[model samples]
Target chain A: MTALLQVEQLEVVYQRAITAVQGISLVVQPNQIVALLGTNGAGKSTTLRAISGFLGLDDARVTEGAVRFKGERIETLSPQDITRRGIVLVPERDKVFPNLTVAENLIANAPRGMTLAERRRLHELVHQYFPKLAELKGREAGYLSGGERQMLAIAGAIVCGPALLLVDELSLGLAPVAVEELTRRLVEIRRELGIAILLVEQSAAVALEIADHGYVLENGRVVLDGDGPRLKSHPDIQEFYLGGSGERRSYRTVKQYRRSRRWYG
Target chain B: MQLYVNIAVLASIYALIACGYVLIYRVSRVLNLAHGELMMLGSYLLLTTASLFTGHPYLAFAAAALLALVVGALVYLFLLRRMTGEMVLAAVLTTVALGILLRGVMVLIWSASQQYPREALGWANPAIALPGGARISTFALLLILSTAAVYLSLFVFLRFSRWGIRMRAAGQNPLLAAQRGISLHGVYALAWGLSTFTGGLAGMLLAMDSGLDGTMVVIGLKAFPAALVGGLDSLVGALLGSLIIAAAEIFLIHHVDPLLSDVVPFLVLIAMLVIRPWGLLGTKEELDRV
Candidate 1:
């Protein structure tokens, strides 16, 4: 089977000068949860935006790369056009329409060929995933807690019936318990909807918790990639990202070790 | 009682026109100063269509209304579309320039004369006697009814319809709205079209009530303070603001000075700005963001 989304040698430059993302390549297979883990400024968000057609908003463009969705190039399309083609991004912040109520937020998304009955069924389905949202349907999204806001954001994207969902920083401002719950829900959503997800996050633990395959990005380049369990157990990932302890090593030693390590991809 | 009648009539007029300002401001965050000129153009269109369909006033009104809708959408599609990514101040200035251009073009086309649209449409403005012994023109009564209808329908449309929710979504977070597959330009164009259609309704009714002239634009300008006092983005605020300004203007005209009629709304607007700059119902965050 073909991949749902493929980003090849994607280099994004902002405002004609600063290169935000440099030669990043990734793919999201159908029904797969692909984790993109990186620290801030590692170009994780930039790569997601590039795939979701939001690069133009920040005066950024794919200077040397291609984003293919269902075997069609989409990096040059408008955000709306890209979204209509089933690549939806749940952005890091301002994820929910603040003034709109939870129900309105769900309804506000552009319906992706869903009949009224089907849309209603999907609404009920979303409510099933997040019962707290159903309880606060009339409350404005601005007043929702961070977790609830995240739920609404995901629900909004789900309503679009996207083939590939790009979620940026899902655990950014949520409590650990909230993050765990949301990550569990993400797994359920992927299984039920059978859609691919490219999950971009700073928290390796939260992302790799359910990701089928994972890639580690450093300075806008993929430094390592493997199956979820393999990446989780990798010495470098365990020490740096998962924060697993190593034999009382000094920071300088770890830095030297990091510099010496090289990928054979 | 007469003062109340006058205030209600004036309030109705301001509310109808102010909604146009609110609609455009809410969706695009751009103050359309050209709305007054567009309103006047709607009245002039009525005149042209009326003369064209000499024996059919309803057809003329419908044709003129349709033209107004098209003109408003075209303004966004052609002129204001270029100003989309610019600073808010620059966009406002573009509208100011557009208003002047429209004014000059209108004068060159229709001439700067007081033309009676009622006469052009073969209709007469008759004074209706109220139960409380207040005399209001028939068209003033229609204005009140039309204002009620417009506000009711707009409230329903914005609160319930999917497109209306989309418009609100677009206004609140344009980038996110675009990310969700909403065409921002389509939403903006729809807002402009609706704003002008309602403004044109106000202009047509007022022109039918009184003879059309250059001063109609001033009346449009005066109504903008109502929009500001109510909040630039809230339709409910617009209605309440119009009532407040209308009451102040009528009371000042009768009790203080006749000349205060023109200045009272602005004075109230300034007072509102000082006390509550975001207007009564407006979200406080909107001012800071804008």
Candidate 2:
């Protein structure tokens, strides 16, 4: 089957001097949950932004390579146009329009054209996934707690009827219980809606638990890629990402640790 | 009673013009310094339309109003669209330049001399005396009525309509709005169109009440302080600010010095800035950005 979304040898440059993402490529099949795992500044967010058509806002651009969605070139489209093509991004920060009431926030999203009944059904679906949102519909989003805001953000994206969802840093600054609940909801959403998700996450344990497939990014390159079970068992992942080793090391070994990992492409 | 009537009339005028400022700023966070010129342009369009549709006064008025809306949208599409991702200061400066250019072009086309549009439209300004011996011109009453109609509709639209909610969404977080498939350009253009539509209405009414002249732009500028005093982003603030400024101007002119009429709004603005920079109904957090 054809991939739902494809990023081929993508190179992103910021302000014409800084190379944030260098020649990295990935794919997402329809209805699949794919996690992009990385540490800080690993070009994970940049890759997602490139696919979501948000690089222009940061004075960054996909200088080389292509982003294709359903066999159409979409690297240069505006964010709204990209969204209309059914790729909705839940960004890392400023995820919701803070001043808008929760109900108004849901109403503000422009879903693909649907009948009145379908719109109502979609609304019901969102409220079903996040029942608390229904109760807080009258409250302004700025007043919502971190977990509630994340739920609202996800709910808003779901309202757009996206075929491919891009979530950046879903578990950041959230309680572990909240993260577990959100991940469960994400799985349920994917199963029910049959939409592909490209989730960028820092926590390997959280992401690997839900992701069907995963890619490990380092220094703007995809250093590793495998199915969920294989990646979860990989030694490097266990030692570095999952805190498998309990023994302490000196500062010199700590500084030279990254060179020791056997990264495979 | 006459002083109260004067205050009401002046307050209505300021409120009508001030909402234009509030609408654009609230959406795009750009201060349209050229709003005065745009308002003047609306009056000038009425003058042109008046002559074109002579003997059809109502048709002329409607056509001019429609033209003002189109002109406002066109301004966004052609000029401001280019400045979207740039600094807010740059966009504001562009408006300043646009204002200067519009002023020069208006003078070149219509000349600097005062022209009466009411005569051109074959309409007469008749004053109706109130019970308390206070007289208000027919256009002044129309201005007050229209201001009420505009504010009422705006509140309803922003509060309940789908597009209105999108506008509020776009204003608060443009990036999130875009991600949800809301076109920023469409929202911004709509804002410009609505702002110019109301501003043009104020200008046309003022022109009809008194007479069209170069001085009409001064009225537009004077309304800016009223908008600032209420808060730049709130519709309620605009109305309240206009009333406060108008009351102070009228009362000070009546009690202190007549010449204080021109400086009253500014004085009130400076004091408001010092005391409560966000204005009465404005969001307090907006103080840092503005």
Candidate 3:
């Protein structure tokens, strides 16, 4: 089976100097939910932006590697062109047009050449997944709670009729309950639409709960990758990411200890 | 009554031109400082078309208007489009340079002589006497009506239309708009096109009312103060700002020295800046962005 997206040895450099992502690679098969887990500045968002064609905005470029969407080379395409090709991103910050109402935000994102009936159907599909958005249709997106904004961002992306959805920091600044609800909704959206999702997340637990496959990134490289259940049982993931160990250790001892990362060849 | 009529006419002219500034600035956050020159270009196009069309004044006028829209969009496509993702100041400076270049080009093409588009189009600007003995020229009345129509249509477009909402979305957050598949270049081009179209209409009408000359550029410059005073992003603010600026200019010209006419709008602008830098209806956060 062909992958929806393939990033082969991707390296992104900012302003032709600082390397943000150093030859990291990952893939998402059609209709699969793939999680890219990393902490702040681990090049997770940079990788996502590289795939989404937003590198140019930050004076960054794909120095070495290619981003392929459904067997087509799309590394040099513009954001709009990339989106038109059916990959939509729900950005981490300033995700929604704040001044626009919820309905206007959704209306603002119809893919090129979409008919009115298709638009209405997509709108209904979005509202069906995020019913709270239907109630907040008249409210300015700026006034929405953190979770509602995320929902609207996703809904807006959905309206674009994307084959792949890139979600950056899905659970950022949201309550646990809200995050769980959103994750469930994301699963439902994926199940119904049969669309692939490349989810960038810092919370491994949240990502692994819904992710079909997961990759752990550290210092701009993929340290480990596996199917969901196997990744969940990995000791390094539990120790560093999930905080599974209960026994208290001295600060000095903990600071001195370093766990060897099992790098994937 | 005559004072009120004069105020209304001047206010309408400023409002029409000021909305051009508001439209471009609101969308791309770059002030098209070349707006006045572009406005003058529209009048000149009308002059050429008038002679070309010969007996058909309406055709000449429509041709000029359509040409202005195309020119506006082309300006974005060829010139301003390159400035995207660059610093906002650089884009604004590009417009400034464009204005100077356009001014020079217009002089070479049309010569320095004042040209009457009204005469070229074979139309008479007869003043219509009002009930209170105030007279308004035919084009000036048209200017008032056109301003109202443009503003009403723009308000409706921005509020209810899908493309209009997309424009607003693009203005507020260009990155997200692009992520959502709305083209930034397309939105910016539309803004430039609409802005130039309206500015061109004001120029065409003003030239018909009063002969077109280099001084028309000053009128365009004067409208900038109106847009700034109302908040550069708000159309309603542009209307209110134009009224305030026109009222100040007309009343000061009547009550004070006539020489104060050119300085009055700038004075109002300075006062507005000192008192409320964001303008009356403009978003408070926009001041920092500027």
Candidate 4:
């Protein structure tokens, strides 16, 4: 498969003597879903942000690196330039444009090249992936629930017709069932749209299960990199985190959530 | 008929100046507190150009507008760029200083004279009737035409152009718009350019309606009431606000005591501030930003 986007020794620095990310590099090939897994502050999110160019005010700088998309250096480019060039980012925390309606939000980021018919067809593609979004078309994004908001964020990125999509922390605060559903849809989208994805997640088990390849980051460095199944079975990963499989625990937690919901009612 | 024409002529010029405040303040989210002084500066520039004409009024107006564009660009680059991301206080104060500067320069250049237009006094005498029993003269028709042309072209330009979309985006979220490759400097320059362009035109027209003097700067001050009452964010709101003020001034000149004449704009201003601070047509989201 052709390399859609590639990075080399990317470094992102924050203002206050803190290096948010130091020399991390990854690739997103067409139809590839590469997962970067670590606990909070492992710089996974920072790495993703540097790629998206959401570097906030002050001396936040991409001190050194080359992020090439379609063989052009894009590390120093603006976020909207990156977006316009077809590398879309769905920011963590399910951040959809709050004031805009779901449809307006989608249309705002939508790629502008087609006849009305093709535009509707692309709209149908998003609806197919997150059918629930179709019903909430006219509703303001601020009013969406956690799951629906995530769906909208995903839909917004896809609308850009990006060659590579960066998704940061897809499961942060999401329900277990919702995470599973979102993961399934993500793989489906990678297949259908033929867009490479670089997904950063805090959870190892869920991340490894859906990922074709995984990079295990510890502190500011990559500790392990391998095929998803091999990394999932690695002893070091189990020793530091994951703690054997989390399936049984997630299932119990799902049941507990239902019971709590019932009791609150 | 001539007397009837004079009111309409003056009213349209008032509306044109009022609308400039509406456009920049509404879209750029700056009060443009110096707008009145800028108009005064523009009029003086017009007068200087018109003095060269001796009898050619049209040439004077055109030259004033052209030169005003260069002045607008200079203000945007030198004054406004420094204050771009500054707080409302800084932006407001900068414009206040700009007003003082413009006034200082006007005195330096023109020596504070009360000057009459080169055209003959008989120019105000011609008149034409409207279907509703209102009548207009040549001066009145020209004023109405210019006013209509300014607003209409601005309305269509902003509504239809790609640059207008960028301006809207910049107004909404400057950072995001910048990220989208819109040059913030360019947008500010365009805003100031439009502001000064219309400002010069309005000043030239008003000077034609009456004689030019140093205190003619107050006409721009009066425009604030119009912009404020109409809602700074809505283009049409300025026109509505100005019409109300003009009507109040016209009817009050003889009907109400002259002592209370200046109080009318203030009264309407206070009422809107208390009742509907957003004005007649300002979008609701602007309230939160304020």
The residue-by-residue lDDT of candidate 4 on A89-193, one tens digit each, is 777753675655677666644354546686677778999999989899889878999989999888877866777888888888989999999999999998888
Off by over 4 Å in 2: A250-257, A260-262, B288-290
Model 3, residue A239: distance off in Å is 1.3
Q: Where does candidate 3 stray beyond 4 Å?
A: A249-259, A263-265
Q: Write the per-residue lDDT of candidate 1 for residues B33-104, one digit (tens) a residue.
A: 999999999999999999999999999999999999999999999989998878888989999999999999
Residue pairs in steric clash, candidate 1? none
Q: How accurate locally is residue A195 in candidate 1, as Cα lDDT from 0 to 100?
A: 74
Instruction: Indicate the TM-score of model 4.
Output: 0.72
What TM-score does model 2 achieve against the real structure?
0.97
Candidate 3 lDDT by residue in tens digits, A148-181: 9999999999999999999999999999999999
DockQ (0 to 1) for model 2: 0.86
TM-score of each: 0.97, 0.97, 0.97, 0.72
Which tens-of-lDDT digit does each residue in A193-264 have in candidate 1?
Answer: 887889998899888889999988887788889999999998888888887884678889878756744452
Candidate 1 Cα errors over 4 Å, as ranges: A246-248, A261-265
Task: Give me the candidate number with maximum DockQ.
Answer: 3
Model 4 CAPRI quality: incorrect
What lDDT is reached at residue B52 by model 4?
79
Q: Please state the error at residue A170 of candidate 3 in Å.
A: 0.8
